[model samples]
Target: MSQKVERYYVPAQSPWPIVGAVALGMIAVGAGNYVASLPDGGGYSGYLLLAGIALLLYMLVGWFRNVIDESMSGLYSAQMDRSFKQGMAWFIFSEVMFFFAFFGALFYARMLAVPWLGGAGNNAMTHEVLWPTFEAVWPLVSTPGGTTTEAMGWGGLPLYNTIILVISSITLHVAHTSLEQDKRKPLTIWLGITILLGLAFLTLQVEEYIHAYREMGLMLSSGIYGNTFFLLTGFHGLHVTLGTIMLIVMFFRVAKGHFTPANHFGFQASSWYWHFVDVVWLCLFVFVYVL
Candidate 1:
C-alpha cells in the first residue's frame, strides 16, 4: 500500500485583505495630499491617513497570523513550500532592483552631473564663469553653489560602524548555521547579538547624521552633493530600520519556539534581507563616504 499525498490550500477568500488594500490605497493618496496641503496649513485628511495606516498594519498581522497557523498545523505541503521559497526569491529580486535604481543615480552623479557642472564637455563657460574652484570628485565635499561639508573619513565612527555591521553579518550567518544544525542556544545567542549590533549601528548612524548637519553644515538642500549623500545613505537607513523590525520579530519567534531546523523560511528570509541591507551600506560607505 502507498501513502496518498494531500495538498494544502487556503481558500481564496478574505474580506479583511480587501479591506486592507483599500485602507492602504487610501493612506497613500491621503498622505500625499496631506503633505501637499502642508504649505497651506490645512487638512484633517491626515487623520484619515493615520487611520488607514493603522488598519493596514492590523490587516497584515491578521493575515500573517493566519498563514503561520496554517503552516504550523502541518497543512503546508512540499508544493506549498516551493511556492513560498519562490515568492521570497522574487521579493528579494525586487529589492535588488530598488537599490539598483539608486545606485544608478549615484553613478550618474559621479560620472556626469558633477563634471558637467564644473564645466566639462559642453559647459566650458560654466567652468570659466562660475565654480572654477570645483573639482570632479565622489561624495563631493564642496559644491558649485558654495556650500561645503567635510566628507566623513573611514577612520572614526564610520569605521567602527563598518566593523559592527560586518560582525553582525557574520553572527547572522552563524545563527543560520546553528539553526540548520539544531543548536538552538547558539542560534538564539548569535541572533540576539546580531540584533544588538544592528541597533548599535543605527544609533551611531544617527549620531553621524547629527554631526554632519550641525558641525559640518552638510544638509539635504545645500547642493547636489549633499542631496545625493543624504538620499543614498538616508534611504539605506530606512531599509535598516525596516530590517531591524523584521529581526526583532524573528527574535520573538525564536524565543517562543517558532522555527525549526527544517522549517524556518521566515528566519532565512529575514537573514537574507538583513545581509542585503548590510552589503548596500558597505557600498555606500566606500563610494559615498570613503571614496
Candidate 2:
C-alpha cells in the first residue's frame, strides 16, 4: 500500500497580523516619545501607549483563540506540529541574542569603559583630562560626573525573588510530569503554585524598585550602574509577568482537559518559555546581583 499524501494546513488570511503590526508600531513610537518627555511635562504619548497596549492585548486574545480552536479541531498534522516547534525554536534563539546584546554591554562597561574612564590603560590621559576625580568601581557608587547613589544589596529582596523563581521553575516541571502521568489534580495544583510564585516574585521586585528609588536614591539617572540595573531587572520582571499570564492560560486549558500527554505542544512550549525565563533570572542574580 502506498502512503497517503496529506495536504498541508494553510490558515486563512486574517487581519490580525496587520493589526498586530500597527499596534507594535504605535507602541514603539509611543514608548520613544514617552521616554523623551519624561524630563519635561507629560505628553500624549502616554495615552497612545495605553491605546497600543490595549489593542495588542485584544489582538493576542483573538489570535490565541483562533489557534486554540484550530488545535482542538484537529486541523493540525504532524508537519504542522513540526513547523510550530521549529518556529518556537527560532523565536527562543532570537530572544537569546537579544539578551546577549545587553549582557555584552554590561561586560564592556565593567571590563573596559569603567577602567578606561578611571585612568587605566591608554585612556589615563583621557581620564585625567576629562574627569580627574573619577575612580573605577563595580556597583559604581559614583559616576565620573559626580552623581552618587547607593547600591542595591543582594541580601534580602533579590535573594528571596531568586528562591521564588527557582522553586517556580521546579514546580512547573513537576506539573509537566504530572500531566505526562495523567494526574490532573497534581498538575493543576503545581501549575497554580507556579503562577502564585511568579506573582509573589513580581510583587517583591516592585518593592525592591521602590526601595531603590525612595531610600537608596537609585533612579535611572543615577548613572550607568542604575541604568543597567533597571534595564536588566525591569525587563526580566516583564518577562516573568508574561510567563505568568501564559501559565494562567495553560491552567484554564488544563481545567478544560485540552492537553493529552502525547499532544501537549502548547503546554510544552509555555513550559520551555518559563524555564528559559528562570535561567535568565539565574544569570541576572549571579552577574547583576552577586557580582
Candidate 3:
C-alpha cells in the first residue's frame, strides 16, 4: 500500500500584496521626508508614515482573516499544505539572506576594515597619520574616528533571554502538537505561556537598549559597532513583534475551533516565522555580543 503525498494548491488571486506595496511606498517616501525635515525643524511628514503603516497593518489583518477562513472551511487541501510550506521556506531563506548582509558587514569591518585602519596591510600612512591610537581590536571599543562605546558582554540579561526564547520555542511546539491531538486546554495553556515568554523577551530587550543608551552612552551615531548592533537586533525584534501578533491571531482562532489537525496552515506558518526569528536572535547574540 502506498500513501499519496500532498501537493500544493495556489489561490486564484490576492490583492493585499499590491495594497501592501502601495503602503510601503507611502511609508518610504514619508520617512524620507521626515528625516529630511529634521535639520529644518519640521518633521511632520511622519503622519504619512503613520498612515502608511496603519494601512499596511489593516491589509495584513484582512488578508490573513480571509486565509484563516479558507483553511477553517477546509478549502485548503493537502496540496495547499505543500504550497504553504514552500512559501514559508522561501520566506525564511530571504530572511537568512537579510541577516547575511549584516553579518557580511560585521565580518568586513572586523577582518578587513579595522585591520587596514591599523596598518595591517602596509598602509603606514593610515595608521601613523589617521589612527595613531587604533589597535585593530575585534569589537573596536574605541574607534579611530574618536567614538568610544562599551560592548555588551555575554552574561546576565542576554543569557536569561536566550533561555526564555528557547523555552518559548518548546512551548510553541507543544501547543502545535496539542492542536493536532485536538486538545484545546493544553494548546491554550502552552500558547499562552509562549506568548508571555515572547513579551518578556521583548521587555528585556527594550531594557537592554535603554541601558546601552543611558548607562553606556552608546547611540545610533556612536560608531560602526553601535550601528550594526542596533540594526541587526532592532530588525530582528521587529520581526519578533510581527511573529507575536501572528501567534496571538492564531491563538484566538484556535479558541474558536478554526483549525483542525489536518488543516492548520496559518498556525504552522506563524510557528515557522517565530522559529526563524529565534534563529536570527542566536546569530545576533553570537556576532553582535558574544563574538
| Prediction 3 global C-alpha lDDT | 0.83
lDDT against the true structure, each candidate: 0.82, 0.89, 0.83
In what order do the candidates fall by TM-score, top score first? 2, 3, 1
Off by over 4 Å in 3: 1-13, 29-42, 143-145
Candidate 2 lDDT, 208-247, residue by residue in tens = 9999988998977778888789888988887888788889
Clashing pairs in 1: none
Ordered list by lDDT, greatest first: 2, 3, 1
TM-score of each model, paired residue for residue: 0.82, 0.96, 0.88
Q: Candidate 1 on 178-290: residue-level lDDT in tens?
A: 99998889988999999999999999989989998899887775566776777788778777876887888788888888888889988988898999988988887888767
**Cα-lDDT of candidate 2:** 0.89
lDDT value, residue 148 of candidate 2: 91
State model 1's lDDT.
Answer: 0.82
Which candidate gets the maximum lDDT versus the true structure?
2
Q: Which TM-score value belongs to model 3?
A: 0.88
Which 10-residue window of candidate 3 scores lowest in summed lDDT? 35-44
